[model samples]
Target: MAELYSRRSFLAGALTAGMLSTSAGYFFTRRNKIQLTLATGADPTGGRQLLVSMWNRLNPNVQIQVREVNSSTQDQFLKFNETHADIFNLDVIHIPRFAAEGKIVPIELENDISLVAPVRRVCERTGTDQLWAVPFNSDVGMMFRRVTDKRADAPVTLKSVLAASATGPVTFAGQLDTVGRQTDEAFVCNVLEHALAQDEAILDEGGVLSYGLGQWRDALAPLADAIRRKRVVAAAGEDDTARAFQRDSLRYMRNWPVRYLPLDRAERARPDTAEIRIDRLPLGILGGQSLAVAADSDYRDEAVRAIHFLTDNPAQKLLTSFGFAPTSVDAYIDADLQEALPHLSLVRYAVEGSRPRPIHANYAEFARRFADHTRRHLHDGEELTQQFITDIRSVLR
Candidate 1:
């Protein structure tokens, strides 16, 4: 067994501002036949549906009619646009655009619980005085390597990891392709992470991107080098990388925190490697959904209360136990969770320092353009020149 965690402080109750004996959870009596529609994608973890079931049991009077929007993030997003659900579990990246468009209503958190910093930031609309949602469940990229033993708080850098790749045992892999997917969200995210790791100033306060010589190309050069050296491989997506790493040759791979549980369990079953040490990458890109209330729902107050229940401490603990990364810091440290998913510290650590992918209303189009531009460069030996950067800049607008 291996143990790991990343640098710095987790976001604690920043959404609540100051913590006192205050709770945002509201309960109502079963006076009326009230059923609120919750629109969320089908959850594999089943943690979310369980939360709904638990909430339903508690407040039988005000029941929830869940409308499982079964599909990918793209499909679910489009479904939300077509349907009028009271509560929406939306991708955190989409929250800003939703806020900007007035599609979702404002939400407040229960003051007693502290959300991870990066998760809290994703809930907030930048430069605005409001938060659109409470982080439902959080995801972030992390490097899982089979190590000999846990080290003593050592810093892992992009330079060091890139150097680790040789024509030998452990090769680096990531979700680098758009294989059989409607959108190239994973591909663009990996690219943005590489660039963001090198230069934090690439994007300005308003999320406008600007970069210079070597800042863009230098970061990706090593990846190309590794590909040429046969130390890195093209991946279909996260699932491909996850399955590829199990083959022993691809020991080091970047994947979601939620993946840690299944991977760890599978490794434990096989005992192929010594110990797997999970690391938070520099400029870790965050991913996940947050619970938001529909602006046009009739049951606005009830929906707000449900959001609190779904995201608060109790719900978070259950969700974490079920292999879903939680939003609350307290959920990460819960005694039972400490044993079941010991790597939660790593999740908390990664998310503390993680950041959301580029936020744009036309993010899907940007992803498409980015994939078309970078695929050849990454998969083949083609170079990404200044023209590549210019094309990206044009699409960003």
Candidate 2:
């Protein structure tokens, strides 16, 4: 009877081991086949699709699904919270707020130091050494003028820009003509770029608001005079300005490098018609999206791998071909890229010196208040009173 009991126990132990081996095999198989979800703003040129296809060819086991969200930062943030996608792209300015809320997961990139210095600098949380996102693509404010004009050495200063405008058609999207709140932020960006170029500090060392109403008014006065004299065509936004420039209605404009892609293609086709020349802005505003992983994502490892794949050298080169400026320094220096992007050197210079927007948890509120008051001052002839300064201070608080 004892022998029979010992044999039964041995058989039971063998059955348990068999079951464990089958479970392990199933787990490993599931781990090898991961599906990742990515949320990003609409890309009309199918660039995002092409990028995903390239990624899939390199990584055959992982599949990526893309979802299109609203272009606004606030809307994207809302979607991030609601969907909890494995990965999401956000504007650099939004990094601080998201980090403060603990919504994003910090990642350790192997080549973090190799990215463009200014672009890499803004990925960290303010007043701390923690990094929250990876730089994907970047844009800066640049001057676009007709190549044939050759007037005033490309307007190195705001004064020079105004002086050149006096000679020919110069238009900017500096108007506060919109009834809705849509154009307010663009107006503020234009103002900040001009102010920074003149060495005016918008925030002090301690990150408190420092630029006074008087200083801002002084910086904007020249543009105001041009608008009044009909020397500057004040459009509503960059799209309007680009369209006007395309139709040969304007000789000079301030726009992003992405806007130059179509113009470049057109010039290539014509080869004899007017071509556009781009140069560094007096001060360029840093603009671009950063990739962040979700803290609660089920596929964190896969998501990180995807981020690395997208930011790798080859992927960055592809991004430039799609009219997006890559953050990788190598991509900027590639000879083929320089030939394709005639303004590559100027872009590199701008990226190196570009000024980051204000970093604060309540930055959205601050921007809204600043834009509202500035627009009112520009359009309604309202005074930049002490009360206005006080209101801005309250919003920052």
Candidate 3:
């Protein structure tokens, strides 16, 4: 057996070699007891634990060993390389890179999986025309406001949000404070959402990089004006905005559904607190995780079975109980789940309309460069000068 390297080292080698070896053989012996190792990020909501329990109940002969990995995708990949875990859970955006590197094996479905069309699309590897991962939970950005607000209608667009804010009926907050290339991922996500709302494309169908320079300017101009006028509260990240909203200092916020879980709990505990109302963003970025079987795993069969068990209708419903949006279309319409999660319809709308970030082997590099320039543009008060635009274009190329 060859030694596994860290994700960074493996990526470097893969880039140089143009491909990774996927010839590892799987050998399984029939036994009374079977064990599988699963590598995944730490779950605060205990959703993974519930899945493990369900799987164990269904297959008493098999036991799963869960190993918690880092939250960072790169760090999770590093753990995956070192452990060669039977099953690896990772972000949907990483599917392209991991599949290209041959770190994850393409999954063959014995029966059709009921994943929403958008979520299913993200799991497919364009280059190989294979399904690289099984969609577990899906997310998309949405606008949240207090239920007590007197607004006659929801802010359906960025222009509407700004207009509402200008009238003093509501104050808007978003993740806009960019520190450096190290700017918050939410900030970068927000920028992409803004651009996409205007029908912009960062990369075309052929995977060629292109900077929608004009679209960037058009999207940011109104947001900049709003920030200047102090109608939109510019916060560092989601937490900051959430805190402000909780204090009734801000009337509207753009954030992920996960943020709502806690706020909803707080509202239930204290009716005096801001009761939240959710609505889909006119456009937003999709965010979520998927499960993939490692190419080098010793328990490929067991791993695939585990992924299937996790994504099944019952398990997906359990996931929604943990505040995760389900990838299954049926889960969105389930009567019981709909009663528990009143925002299910709004979430379904957002997920259907949301777009995934650009998928490419070099996406990590592209995201870093995009964040760096957008941060400078938004925070440093740098005008989108011709030279600066050229620099942005150069980074994408």
Question: Pairs clashing in candidate 1?
Answer: 11-117
Query: lDDT tens string, model 1, 1-397?
Result: 3332111011222212222123324457748768899988777666688778767766777888888876565445676888789988898767766777888988766546888777787677566645688888888778877554345334465546567775444466777666644436676677666666666665443345664646666766766676666676557678788778887545577777767766765665454455555777866777889889899999888888888877878777767766677888898887756765567787787777766656776665555666776777877767777877776667566
Write model 2 residue lDDT over 1-397, tens digit each, in one string: 2343344345334433433343221122234677778878777655556767656655557788887776554344566667758888887867877888988888877553368877877887555665688887888878776655445434455557676677765554333233344555566667676656554576332334564777767766766566666676666667666776666545567777777766655653543445667778756777888889988789887788788767666666667766677788987887766765667888888878777777776777777777777667666667677777887788666
lDDT of 2 at 397: 64
TM-score of each: 0.83, 0.83, 0.82
Q: Which one is best on lDDT?
A: 1
Candidate 3 segments whose C-alpha is farther than 4 A from its true place = 1-32, 73-83, 127-129, 149-156, 166-170, 178-183, 198-210, 228-230, 268-274, 385-397
Q: List candidate 2 segments past 4 Å from native.
A: 1-32, 125-130, 149-157, 164-182, 203-209, 267-273
Pick the TM-score winner: 1
lDDT of each prediction vs. the true structure?
A: 0.69, 0.67, 0.69
Candidate 3: tens digits of C-alpha lDDT, residues 1-397: 0121133234333322321122112122446788787888777777667678656655666777888865554334445667657888887767777888999899875434577878888888666646799888898888887655445544566557775676665467777675542335677788766655554464333334345567667767766666766777677777777877767645678888877776765764555433667788876688888889988887788888778767766667667766788898887888766765678888998888777776666566666666666667766666665654565455444
32 in model 2: Cα distance from truth in Å?
5.6
